[model samples]
Target: MKSLPRLSPTSYALLGLLARGPATAYELNNIMQTSMLRVFWPRADSHIYSEPKKLLSHGLVSEEKEKVKGRDRTNFTITAAGRDALAAWLAEPDAATHRNQAEFMLKVILAEGGSPDDIKATLARALETTRTETRMAIAGIQHIIDSPEAGVRKGMPWNGMAANLMADILIARLRWAEYATEAAAAVPDDSDRAAKEDIGLAAYQRALQRLQAELDP
Candidate 1:
């Protein structure tokens, strides 16, 4: 009946993963690298290691220490309170925001002095990376959606829905990356703000349309 303390989204991510089962920080990192990283790209391993302790302090999760190959390992499991809190958070509107602001701003700043060719190369690499990550994410999500256990989870279709959304977002990102690759080449060395804005706006509108189509009810 107590109100859950407002915590960072990272805390809920840890709790949600633990709701499935107990996991050491290492295992959580592996899970993130495999799946969660597609959705929450910027979290570091250090944050994973530290977050469970915060949840434990709040009585949302409990931890136990074990000896693993002569070293100590701490594994965390969600408490009932954690499950309740996670459910409550999920029912609220998602507060997650895109992580591209600083990178995009830096690109704009660098366009003032950096060579167009260099910028093109950077976006080219990003496009390739997005392609690779999106492919892997689709495969992973499809695997989950195909699994029989997916329906038996408490969250059921929402987990499947979230996976579907991730795939859609990645596809949208791929579109934007492709557009960015072309626009980077077209950008003039003078850093024409209007031209850059036009390029970005076009890419954004395309991506938004794709996402909106997926979420249309």
Candidate 2:
């Protein structure tokens, strides 16, 4: 038997969305735009439009067309093979090499090359964005609770778990951004490089202690 082609993460994301029910690419894009999926696996509109076709070719999804108001509309639904693939993917252990690809995080990692003000501005932007996301996450959770029969609420325990995780991550990012902003503001003059190093070292030590406590507790 021929081995199946390796699917990209985007393919799996689309399959996961279809697993909920049939949806057009437009519907999938709308869901990604408005939900925690956007927070985790954001993709371009074009990619969303095209990935479903690829899944269909791979025999993982089936497509149907209907006339709605005299215009053809296409919807994609997960096939049995797609469900098995998604289940196997979910069962696989998370790759240890996985790293955050957030641009703001990249800037933070490279902040030493930039001026203090530049780093401070990046942190400010990140904090503001995270605050907005946190609000949306809270609103989403509230919506789920308010409308138990809504389509988005179909995945009972998993929906709640995913929403809670997104909210927790956003809260953690908000806290980190606040701390980094404060630390940037406290940077001493160039002449006191030692003091700056001390500040960075202290922050590192605090993080290390937190990890150690988590491991022990």
Candidate 3:
């Protein structure tokens, strides 16, 4: 199998959104929040401004100025290159590996300050979020599967495959959350040890932030 070119997940997501029609950055953000938040890329206002510029630089998308409510705004449309990129990504056999462990790690770090009640509350919230997200992902995928238009796509399976992948990820994460909640509940509350651990973690976090600033600046 040929290896695909490296593109951040956000890039492909923006391309996919543009495939539907031209849209301003604000509109894309709204669409993401309303419809794609559970099923697609992680939501960030940074991506709203950044990803399109990257796509535009790569010749995958084009921008036009339009007037809306007396102010000129830029609208982005997918180029042929963009569409091709999106289609290729959709059809690609290999699934991208995700780096999603940071969220779990963040919770571990924050456990330093959490009381037993706080832990229980946090666990309950985590479980609820996992369940709700999984449910939404499943429903979103099923909607596509049941839609008459979805069957007629050049490769119907491929179209559904992306949504299915999301559903699978959500389900897997839900299971992980269930396990994590039980394990967390079993741990004895040790605030002193947690505080010591947090001191180390805080140093590491500061170093990481410095590195991030250096890299991005």
Candidate 4:
């Protein structure tokens, strides 16, 4: 099979969502607003509308036109080429460059220049958002556990695992936000490069420990 041209992570995101089902640009904007997409890897709605043309250039997706009450209605569909590309992506290692968009680097990068108060405020806003997400994720898991989907009605068998994964991710992010908030608050404005290196090193060690614990076999 001819290799489909590589697409941006955002383009891949659009194609992957389309693979689930045909959607209008408006519907996709709604999807982007609710999930982790809404937070870490947020894409503007305009990008969603534009990527389809690029996907079309690469033979990845198609658009269909309909009329709703005398208005033009355009819906996008993933093509066979798109499905093939998505499958190839899923089979590869997820340790890709796209992971850095998570915004955690803001704490370390913006350690200086801005007023400490401003840095604190930026982090506070992000922390509050993550905390709310953490709560929503917890509530969703509770709702699922209190009544299994299969037991309740016609529902997916493997969906519980997906929900659990989401809950675990949000919990991890919440813990990170909590820790970063404190760490950022601890460092003073006049700290020199050496001191900031120490902070970065300490964070790296902690992350290493966490990874080791998770990967213990």
Candidate 3 local lDDT, 1-217, one digit each (tens) = 4343579767787787788789888877776765544355556677667777788878889999978899999999999878888998888787555555446447655865656777577767878988887677667656755777732242345555666566677776777678667766665565476765675577578769978998998
Candidate that would win on lDDT: 2
Off by over 4 Å in 3: 1-9, 31-40, 57-59, 67-73, 80-95, 101-105, 109-114, 149-155, 186-217
Local distance difference test, per candidate? 0.75, 0.84, 0.71, 0.74
Which is the better candidate, 1 or 4, if ranked by lDDT?
A: 1
Candidate 2 Cα outliers beyond 4 Å, as residue runs: 1-3, 69-71, 91-98, 189-191
lDDT of 4: 0.74
Q: Which of the two, 1 or 3, has more lDDT?
A: 1
What is the C-alpha lDDT profile of model 2 across 1-217, one tens digit per residue? 5455599888998889899899998898888778777877788888878888899999999999999999999999999889989998989898645245699989988988888788889999999988988877788888778885768487778877777767777878999999988888878546377887788789999999999999997
Candidate number that wins on TM-score, 3 or 4: 4
Candidate 2, residue 98: lDDT: 27
Clashes of 4: 0
Question: lDDT tens string, model 4, 1-217?
Answer: 6866977778877777887789888877777776545544677778777777888878888889999999998888999889989888868776654354645456547647667787777777778988888787667556656874453322245455556666666777778778878888898877888998898899899999989998993
**Model 2, CA-based lDDT:** 0.84
User: After superposition, which runs of candidate 4 have C-alpha atoms over 4 Å from their true positions?
Assistant: 1-3, 36-41, 91-98, 102-104, 136-165, 180-217
Q: List the residue pairs that clash in candidate 3.
A: none
How large an RMSD does model 2 have? 2.3
